[model samples]
Target: MMDVEVIENSNKCARCNYCRVCPIYTVEGWESASPRGKLYTIKSLVNGEIDVDARVVKELFKCTTCGSCEVICQVEIPLINLWENFRAHLNSKGYILPVHKKLREKTFREWNPYGESREKRADWFKDLKNLTSTNSDLLYFAGCTASYRTLSIARDTVELFNKTGLDFNYAGVDEYCCGSPFLRTGQRDLAQKLFLKNYKKWKEMGIRRIVTSCAGCYRTIAKDYPKIAEKLDYDFDFEVLHTVQILDEIVDEIDFEDVDVKATYHDPCHLGRHMGVYEEPRRVIEKMGIELIEMEKNRENAFCCGAGGGVKSQFKELALAIGELRVKEALNTNADYLISCCPFCKLHISQSLNNFDKNINVLDIVEVVIRTLNK
Candidate 1:
């Protein structure tokens, strides 16, 4: 039998071209790249009008899962979930992309998609003593990207937590990947295992509030985990928060020295459209006394940085092309820095800026706060 959700969501597409404003569609310029076009493809495949092929796989997986198309869908179809369900369906039939398969393998082996050693996961802040006690109720989940690739964001977040006298526990070496990559790439079984592991660990540790610096991690934990928990018949009771949410709540309590820089914020797809966390990060930037400029596309309508949904891993050229467009928009603001809440976004956007030979600093919001505090 065909996947009912895929067929239903695809049939719901009005084809009014609203989802044509998508970032991938902008770069690829093919109807197949547009969300509308993909929906048609999905319906045709599910109805047996078309067979599963490489072109079909590419067109489907090319999406960034940014939720922009979902925002524009007139019929209010849940596009993100549909995409994941279809991808999961495809994976079960052995249509998984090679890189995405490797990603799953790495995550299973190292507990992170980056293939970094699990023992070294907490090396970034293991020496920062007295700030993170395992006995604390608040857990700081400095996700895989922040812990492994963007070490400074993790350090800065820990510093901010310490400065604010916020007692939190770091899962340290025991922290597994929150399973964002697995879910996005259609490894549902792997994602469920990760959810169970993390959820049970938190429950056993008496964790009440979970905080993360990466937007992907925040979205996965705060939004995706609960759904998986319900499916698995587990009770999820933890309060998940992004670092900006916590920082926003404590902003007035800190002494922030003015940092003289004009910066524009890029809304990470996971944080902005997926989770409706548009203003908190912006409000925090404003609290630092830095001039925050608006991009041509900002908040709900913001273009993706092209790092999500396993696009960056599988379609490198396509991902960079999309990233270049967003970086150009950041350059148009002529700000001294481009600020974003996600380390993954910073990594991709910075790469795009370099490829275009443009000079502009990319910093996470926590990095900005730490800079102001020291100055």
Candidate 2:
């Protein structure tokens, strides 16, 4: 049975097509691709007008859940939550997407989402002798991508943290997926389980504050955790912060060497819009003494990199295409680097740049900050 909250909230949409006009669907140009269509289908299922078949399920899965529709919705409906509830409902009924199901299995079996062992999580930080302290109040939750795929980010973040004289510690093998992917994909039960595990571990470790380089993890930990804690009665005493926020706070303490580069920033969906963190990253960029060019569509109106909401895993080509569009936006700025605070955004946009014959550089905000810091 669908939760009463889900049923009532999902039915609240008045079928207005404001969400349909999103740039993503506009660029893709399909009715089924619009948020209104997805919501309508979900509403029909709740009203017993349609069955939860593979086709219906696929329609729900198509969304990146970028929350663009929610921002433009006249009724202020929680479109992403509705989609997540629909996903959870579908999953409960034995209708799970093959890609998401496989990824979930891997996440459950191996603490990391990439089916890698947990011990290797901190292997990337092996050479950082400056990161030896565990008693520091600052805890760096490198997320899955920085921990595994973009190990350089992990190293650079540590180097920057030390260079700025901030005592930082990592969750190391104890860090798991931030449950953002699972939550975004409608695996709420799995997300809750991972949340409880991570929350409890962090609490016990006496971590008073947490920071993550991944926008997805930042959103989940900073925003979603409090909600989950209320539901699960888990008491969280720590403050969750993004690396950009921390770096911005400490920007005055560091002086940048003259490194001339024109850069544009890509606002990760979760970090910028979902979490209202638009200024801190831009502040970091401006403070770096670099030429910060704005993308035509930036801030809340920014386009998604398409890898969000498990789209990268399920619809690789679509994700890449969306990423390519974002790359073009950066290239249009004539920027040397596309500085994004999210690791996943960096990964997708960097891949798009490489694959699409673009010379634009993609960088994480920490990398940029670290490079600017006196070595």
Candidate 3:
């Protein structure tokens, strides 16, 4: 059974519809697309008031789980976790979405969410041996996307690490997905399995601290894993740090060449709101000596890239719509480039910009750092 407390607390939403004003659903303009609608549907299912149908299940899977609704809710409903629990319950009832099911299966078998071979996981570090040292206290956890699709980010991050004189080691194939995807999509059992595998590996390697570039991975490792660990009687005693946080700590030691580029940042929901890490990334950007332009909505109130909550895989159109809105917000700043700390945000926003034929450039903060270092 799902957590009783979560069910009780979530049911207190009272259908106030305060959360319907979120930019995501406002842009989509659908009632079933809103968080309250999904919550009521899930509550009905739990109360046996309505049978679980494919249409109802599809609505539940569409949400990015960005928690914008929870942020604005007067009743303080844990909508994100509540939706996740409902997804898990639906999966247990054999109602898995096809794409998500395939992704989960591949992640379970291949150790990466993309379902690719693990042998190529370390390909991003090719010819970059000088960038990392063998003995370093800092461990860079390059999530699957950066390792494969966004190899440039992985390369730039390592270059910045070397430029900053930070000792770093990366676990290549030995590293597995941090299980953020699984957790967000309601495959908690699989997420727990992945966490156990990763925690054991990190423990055996004597890793005292961890840093991640992916906001989802950062939140999962730093926040979710601890609770999972408690249930399994496993103690994970390590500092889970975001790369931006680490970069902020050493911002003073580095110097950047003057770059006259206007840039705006998109706050990845997991990193900015969920983890409360808004300042460090901004600090790093300012330290780079670039003009930091703020979107009308930023920090805790910033919009989501629409890639979270398994929406990218389940509802591609809606995810792209959310990403397009974010891209437009950055473009409104008239910034030459848009910067985000999360690789997933970078990927989604980049696609949206291309699709919309907008000229705004999308980049990771590490990419900006590496560029400034070279300049």
Clashes of each: 0, 0, 0
* Residue 67, model 1, lDDT: 92
Off by over 4 Å in 3: none
Task: Give the per-residue lDDT of model 3 (tens digit) for 1-375.
Answer: 767865786679777888985655777778777888777776787788998888888877887778788788898877777878878878788888888888888987889989888999998886577666556666889999999888888888888887777888788888899999888888888899889888888887778899998999999999999999999998878799988988898888887888898899999999987889899888888888889999988998898888888889878888888888888889899998799999989988888887666598799998888788745
Off by over 4 Å in 1: 129-134
Worst 10 residues of 3 by lDDT: 129-138
* Residue 159 displacement (Å), model 2: 0.6
Off by over 4 Å in 2: 10-15, 21-24
Candidate 3 to native Cα RMSD, angstroms:
1.5
Cα lDDT tens digits for candidate 2, 1-375: 886777787667777787864645766777777887776776787788988778777767887878888888888877777777777777788888889989999999977668888878878877677466467767889899998898888888888877777887777788888899888888888888889888777776778999899999988998888888889887767788988888888888888888888899999999877889899988888888889999988999898888888888988888888888888888999998899998899888888887666598788988887777766
Evaluate model 1: give its lDDT.
0.89
User: For model 2, which pairs clash?
Assistant: none
lDDT of each: 0.89, 0.83, 0.85
Select the stronger candidate by TM-score from 1 and 2. 1
TM-score of decoy 1:
0.97
